[model samples]
Target: MDFTFSTEELLIQQMAREFAEQYLRPATRRIEKENRVPDEILAGLAGLAGLDLFGMNIPEQYGGAGAGYLSYVLAMEQIARVHCGPGLILSAHNLGLGAIANFGTDEQKARFLPKAASGEHIASFAFTEPGTGSDPKQLTTTAVRRGDEFILNGAKRFISNAGYQGPLTVFAIEAESGVPTAFIIDKFCPGYSISQPWEKLGWHGGDVVDFNLKDVVVPLDNVLGKIGDGYPILQFGIAYGKIGMNSLALGSTLAALELAVRYANERTHREQPIAKFQAIQLKVAEIAGLYESSRWLCYRLGFLANDPKSYRDFAREAALAKAVVARNAQEAARISLDVHGSYGLMQDAEIARVYRDAAMGPQIEGVLHMQQIILAGDILRKR
Candidate 1:
């Protein structure tokens, strides 16, 4: 892997960092407190720096930067270090667009990719149902084939972009054939509704929509891939998405560590800087180790993403990266809070927000035990 970034990469990194410091960090607390990312704010941010365009891996022809995984990862890191909600929204939109750009038919690409890549139409991926957590094959949502339309009836709980507000790519099992399929369901679809609002432990500003589709009619042209082929497409898309999430978590943890180090160095302990204390030195050292390890793992995953054919073999690695970084982030946040003491717990402090937000990592996206199980299975298979 090349450690050097081209001039373009450096410029993108600097640009993203400035956006985070200027717009995202200033409003991070307000968003977390209100638990709402106003549509106007989202739109303004999308317009200002074209946050949606830079982090996307889609091609320039599709109105994106045509950047690489590392570029996206770096941008995600910088944005998430201050505010993961905006970062997640951008990531999900890009992931949805990436899925279609890579797998969709020419017409599908021409229809959906441009709007999504340009950030004119936000994209959301709906795969997880209440009945099916990690297993797509067991999805209870059913799509029945009609003449020129498929009638979709099901409920999707804990969806990222649930409201019909955003353009959606929904996955449901075709009833007759028992095959998973992806559909481009428009907001005007007859029987689609966001039934409930979900509040999460972290990432408060992002929407966690619950979709209820009752006799929803979707045209045959909306099918994302060949019949019975949506499972692989979704799996591949989510693998890359998880890598981006790991990058965000690692970046947040590093930011927390930096905050802690600064606090320790300037903080006075018996008329001398607390940096002189061996305990503070040890804490900083441990944080440095955690950040370095997580960052390297994220880079390795970026390299792996460059060649997707190798991803199947990397499921365990991806799961491991998610688990390790999630755990590392929470630990780092706690250390930062402890080092800062009272100041860290204040709502105005960045560490407090980072502490609250670090937990969004491990909840559903490859929990530690799940990753351990996968890693153990890989070990046994290799042995």
Candidate 2:
């Protein structure tokens, strides 16, 4: 098996690293303090001459770079290492974009993708509600047909990019069929309103909020795929979403490792560096191992995502990778914090921010235990 990245992949990875160091690294403090990414940074990420980081996975015809999933993952790792806010934004945006790309008709792609790819709009996927965390059966959202338009009513919770103007892919139960369906609707339409952003535990700049859809109108043509197809579309969107999530976690893992090693070498004990301590050495080794293992799992998942033989199998693998990588990132952050000792506890410490960011990976997308259940079910079904 060829384990090396191609030249193009390396170039994209380098470009992302440079962008993160040049732009995101300097702005990290502001982003964390303000809990918002500047519009200029977002524009640069999208409109930069050679670095269309925001549209890495979109097709070239859609005003995107079409760099494929592996390139996207590589770029995300670098972007997230400096700061996870941009990575989180891209991850959620791709979740909505992936659903449309995989399930939407040609007309739908033509209409929605160009502007989204250009970063003129940020896309969002709305499926989770206050009552239904990951369970689709408990969805309270309703969509009713009215002539050529559908009226939607529901409240979506913890939806990322909902506050932004873009196409939102929403899942709801149809009044006539009683079957769950997916619809593509514009955000901030006549009947849509969003709550103030929820102050989350980490990833501060990635805005997530609850939104109310009261008699939201969408044309029948906006129905994604077909009626009763929301389940598969949700599955596909989430499976791909895991790719971005894994990349973010892996980046956090790498950051934790680097911080631990740096702290070990720089911190002195009795005029000697802490790197001389066996305990510090062991902690650094553990963090390195976690970073390496998580890196390979994320890269493999990205490769498999490029052209999966079966999305069912792909989803299972994504679940497995996310479970391991997310846990590794959290563990790595913990170990790094231990290395930092009292300093890491300070709110402004960089390692402290990494700790909070890593803590979020296991909870978002799907909880760690939920991923375990998915893996267990897949294994038992194969048996």
Among these predicted structures, which one has the highest TM-score? 2
Candidate 1 lDDT, tens digit per residue, 63-119? 766777767777778878878877667767766776787778888887777766666
For all predictions, the C-alpha RMSD in Å is 2.2, 1.2
- TM-scores of the models, in the order given: 0.92, 0.98
User: Which candidate comes out best when scored by lDDT?
Assistant: 2
Error (Å) of candidate 1 at residue 61 is 1.8
TM-score of 1: 0.92
Error of 1 at 132 (Å): 3.3
Instruction: Tell me the deviation in Å of residue 165 in model 2.
Output: 1.1
What is the Cα root-mean-square deviation between model 2 and the actual structure?
Answer: 1.2
Give the lDDT of residue 200 in candidate 1: 74
**lDDT tens digits, residues 82-194, model 2?**
89988898899989988988798999999998888878889999999999878889999999999998999999999999989999999999889998899999999999999
What is the number of backbone collisions in each predicted candidate, taken in the order shown? 0, 0
